[model samples]
Target: MSVTETVGQTPLEAASPFEMRVDLGKDVPETDVRSALKSGEIGFLHSFTTGSAVDGPGIRLVAWTTSCMFRCQYCHNPDTWTLSNGIPVPIEKAKEELRKYAPGLKAMHGGFTLSGGEPLMQSRFAVRLFAAAKEMGIHTAIETNGYYGDKLTDDELAYIDLVILDMKAFDPVQHKRVTGMDNAPVIEFCERLAHLKRPMWFRYVLVPGLTDVPEEMDRVAKFAASLGVVEKAEILPFHQMGRYKWERLGLDYKLAATTPPSNELVAEAVAIFRNAGLVAD
Candidate 1:
């Protein structure tokens, strides 16, 4: 049964993206779903949370969408993998949600950011949302894996002020092992963005035994440096905050025993990016 009847078609703003949500949009007819996807009339959203400082340049109102192509082992919100787990919100409504905070956001030098479950999974919706943010004179950003970067055309891409790309791995084998997908498309997207002169910030998660390989990180640093469009590289230390999500969803948690990377490990990763002549933190 679609949870729309059991619950509500519209979702209240979530206190945090970590809150579990399920089957919120399952009641919509298949035809309607397809229409929404094609026209960008609506989007499947997990929740909207305000006052995020790390997602973009300033404090931000971040919308967490549903559906993703990558099956990353270290995913924090496994529930977001299901499209129906998100509420089917019309684009206008989503815009209104942004409008509510526009004044304060502008005053704070903040804007809007669309994050996911891979925002590009709902390509049309993602573009439309960015456009709406731009209309309101707010800065816009998207956090993506770049697997479906082609989904947005150059015109549509203009609305996005920044692209916060989460890079899993640089090596093909390691990338496949981490995301169960090849990184070729990702590299292509990054190159395209560089050619377009789009400012970018690349983030690498420092998973001790998994992604902390020195040579691989060095390659990534070099790539970012070569891009010339990468303003900064961020080395994120992996954490166990999302382990319980995997358990609750009955998925195998591969990194259950893996502790967060030590400070020394994180420093080394940062230094690799810095040595490549890209500002890293």
Candidate 2:
């Protein structure tokens, strides 16, 4: 279909990543979707939000991909858990969309960031899109869980300008508790980037009563400190903005009444990273 048909007259524009977007690719056959994922010619995007400064350096245009293996209890966009929920867009189309903002993005020192339910789930699409963005002279970043960090070849990884790794937890048990996944590959990815001297920004989500453990965060902070490539460490306080999505989708909303982390909590987390000699905010 066309962009107009997929979502309005232009590319899908979401007010924010928290906006509920679903069934954009519901009509595609399973076989075709699988083929596209393997080829990277087309990507399944949940939505693309423009003018985002929180995702990366300066103002950014961030694309949110669909599908993820982790079922983090604090996850806000539960709608992205299924790949088929995304809108199907060809690689060239995505490039065209990026091309439109390339000039302004460069002028503003901003670029493109492909975030996700877990972007590496659509590894090929993300790599190809990053390459396209690079060719356009636009900086590229990925906000990822680092679970599928191996999906990008070293050469492919070079296409990316920065990696905003959302390293949830360091301890395997806590990692599993937070994101329902292994932490080994995530750490390995961080180490690999350090070895390559690739620039990185580490982010940890501070959830009340769940991931607020000082010892656990200190471990993560120290690990990020050891990486040497982490230029910025951001402690993203967990918010309930996505709680409505779960309620609407009829999914079990565990953190139904969970509030955002207090300011003191945020400051303490930042201090932990700062104490490790890393620039933090």
Candidate 3:
């Protein structure tokens, strides 16, 4: 099948900076966006959550889009890692789902969140989705690995309300080894994202000896604090809830021997980032 058929829509016109830049590499030009949207060339998304309290500040409508370019060892959603794993529901349908919880969202002052195996992996879809959400006055957020930030246009940056950047590891070599990619893009993405002056949440998975090293945590903390855009620094205690996915998929459970960090350990990591002048949540 063609890429368009796979995704189910031709994207809307490249009306904003984000759209034009994101689609710059394509054969289609920005001038053709309106026609494309009218022609239904841009396919809408599949599904989304109506109410999620954990992803952002208030209750949130989350769109967990399928597809990812990375293969992290401890990923909780290995099932969501593939582009073709889930049913395609369309973006309008997704919005309809979010509306069901609109009353709750207004009560909690919450909005919409887009997350995935790597949302950036589906940047085109994300750009389209964000545009749609923004038109509806929904406060939009993204939970991403920061790998695709640089590749986007400035206009795209304007649509997002918040960005929660996940730092896989402070050490580049370890990060590449663990996540099957280098850390340079992730780091560069963060720095460029800072220029947008959007609220950012830097999250790290405290993987015992692997990611909890005092020196490394300090380095990460310092880097994040230096960014000046971080609204919150969160230390996510590593867990094995997804280990079973790896087992079921017949993939190697490299971190299988690893245990979750103690609350004290988590606290210590939190302190390091906090001490560096970043808020820890």
Each model's lDDT comes to 0.89, 0.89, 0.70
Give me the overall lDDT of model 3. 0.70
TM-score, cand. 1 vs. native:
0.96
Positional deviation of residue 80's Cα in model 2 after best superposition, in angstroms: 1.0
Candidate 3, residues 224-268: lDDT per residue as tens digits? 988889988889999987777677767778898999999899888
Per-prediction tally of clashes: 0, 0, 14
| Candidates, ranked, lDDT | 1, 2, 3
Can you write out model 2's per-residue Cα lDDT over 112-179, one digit (the tens) per residue? 99999899999999989999998899999999888899999999999988999988889999989878
What lDDT is obtained when candidate 1 is compared to the true structure? 0.89
TM-scores of the candidates in the order shown: 0.96, 0.96, 0.81
Candidate with better lDDT, 2 vs 3: 2
Over 173-256, each residue of candidate 1 has an lDDT whose tens digit, in order, gives 999999999999999999999999999999999997899899999999999899999999999899988888889889998999
